[model samples]
Target: MTSDRDWTGRVGDIWATEWRRTDRSFERLAPVLNAAIVAAAGPQAGTIVDIGCGAGATSLASAQALPDGQVIGIDLSPKLIAVANHRAGSLGNVAFRCADVASAVGMHAPVDLYVSRHGVMFFADPVAAFAQLDEAAAPGAALVFSCFAERAANRWAVETVAGADDASGPTGAMTAPGPLPLPIRPMSRRC
Candidate 1:
């Protein structure tokens, strides 16, 4: 399946060739993800930068939350960015770019707040990538991101998806993006 990661700009499809399951979940869970991001933005009264804007789900949410401000969602997927821009026609406050996170940081002006969800964790080099983002902030600006604690701290994954290589790329996959909370299916063991 394709993905927002490989974006090409088609509505109703973000990550088309990646994990089909993720695409399925993405459509259904977009609003919830938007809500979470919107809540974190907290009033959204300033420039909001979403590193992996991902088909504008978060970017659109940011635009709504920060009506007075602008939201720039940057990603490497042209398809995804195109879809975001097409959907964002004439909005004037939200801009989605088909650019790498680092490239966007270099070109984008310093902003009030910089926000990223699961994007940062996939960096080929986290320290270097973060340093670039760190440079793109104004004084007193806030940088918030959630990263994994440690493998030892969370093993439910290790036990459940053996050999899944959860975070591995060229370096490794043990890194945590965030401990995503799955909706549980209640069991009827006894009352």
Candidate 2:
């Protein structure tokens, strides 16, 4: 059985190789995606943590969006992080680190905002990882992320990949703000 570190290392290697060839395509989407995230999270004034920030596109965007804030983009691929750092040249408010967020140490604590661009889904232990994130976030800090939907919901990609399912399953909410129940769905009647 592979340990968490081993598993994450392998995953990182795979992404590093894949992103080296395709990172540019994702960079093209950063503007729109970053705009939406900045709009939703509003302008951050403190620190923002960008989990799995490949090539630092989102992190650079966050830094640009929040001039007063510091952005830290963490990923497990040193090669990708290198590219991210190169791309972030002269960006005083932004930095990228090559480390696995699931077990990464020295996270900037009391983070004002924690943003993940399709990052959390790859955690070997989602609950534990989020627990660490929850501890890192300040009280009332905002958390925002986007993940791919179910396989059936992404038929185009499935068909394009020759009917091979990537098996991207949902991890559900690991924790919620305050005492709110996970998901925070609407109720038919008042509780």
Candidate 3:
């Protein structure tokens, strides 16, 4: 049986080995991530927690926005966290920790804002991890994260898949880029 610790360790090992290469791509997304966080949290986001903060670029950017506030960048990979800390040098309000957020409930201060850029998807238990993050935040705190809906919704991915498969990539179900009716409905009750 695969224990939780074992799984977490394995994940950390994989990222530790791949962080150098992955960091290059992740660096490019910092601007977009900043935009998303700014839009969601608005100006003056106090006490932010960045989940799955790979190399802490988004975390550093967020800390810059909140000069008086604090930001904690959390990740499972020790190597990535170390890099983040090294990069954080003279930044007093910014800090990085190697931890599994899903299991670190009540370990953080109540945050005014929470940001995750392409980071929330790696959770072993996404619902539980989100619940933990929610618990760690103050009431009325804003949660902001971006994720691509599906392969069909992403233009670059669609092009890549089409080219890879001789121009034949998932017919019929793929919705073209435009307004498409969704089956979603407003929730009448709060969970």
Candidate 4:
């Protein structure tokens, strides 16, 4: 499991540095995910939160898609937040913040939509984290996110980290909690 400390420090720095590559890696999935988010949010969505927004690509895209809506990208990495802010430039509808979305969601209360791209996988306690988001959301708020299919399904990811290993052991496998083939199962239900 990736800890908050990792995101706040070395891991975060690496992501910030390699954000361009990371974004490119998600090129195929991003459009599909963004389209789902836009469809869920609709044009009248007043406020949207991009949970675990790394370099703000999703946030920027959503902001551009919904010019009348406000989009806030929240992440645990200061470096990532910096990159996001820099990329945002003069976009009036989007903003980035370095903070835990579980705790910070309340700050942007009544959010009309919540979106992520393989971001929620790192949460230590996803159930509790999502509960908080539920609490802070508007009556008809929509949540949309995407996570990796599985170790086998995503050959690109496995190949990319073929030799990498963390404290868990030397399997070169990701240690995120939940189902092996599909992590989305936990959050699949409608409220």
TM-score for each prediction? 0.64, 0.71, 0.70, 0.85
How badly does each model clash, as a count of residue pairs? 20, 0, 0, 0
If both were scored by lDDT, which would come out higher, candidate 2 or candidate 4?
4
Indicate the residue-level lDDT of 48 in model 4.
94
Error of 4 at 27 (Å): 1.2
Which segments of model 4 are wrong by more than 4 Å? Answer: 152-191
Mind giving the per-residue lDDT tens digits that candidate 1 earns over 1-191?
Answer: 22333233552243533333544556755566566556655664577788776666667767876688788888777666666787678888898877768757767767666666556555655567767876776555665443334444447654555566674412334332324332223232110
Runs in model 3 with CA error above 4 Å?
1-28, 42-44, 155-191
Select the stronger candidate by lDDT from 1 and 4. 4
In candidate 2, what residue range of length 10 has the lowest lDDT sum?
Answer: 182-191
Clash pairs for candidate 2: none
Clashes of 3: 0
lDDT tens digits by residue: candidate 2, 125-173: 6678878887777766776665555434566644654644645533455
Clashing pairs in 4: none
Better TM-score candidate (3, 4): 4
RMSD of each: 9.5, 7.1, 6.5, 3.8
> Using alpha carbons, what is the TM-score of model 4?
0.85
Off by over 4 Å in 2: 1-24, 27-29, 40-44, 160-191
lDDT for residue 118 in candidate 4, whole number 0-100: 75
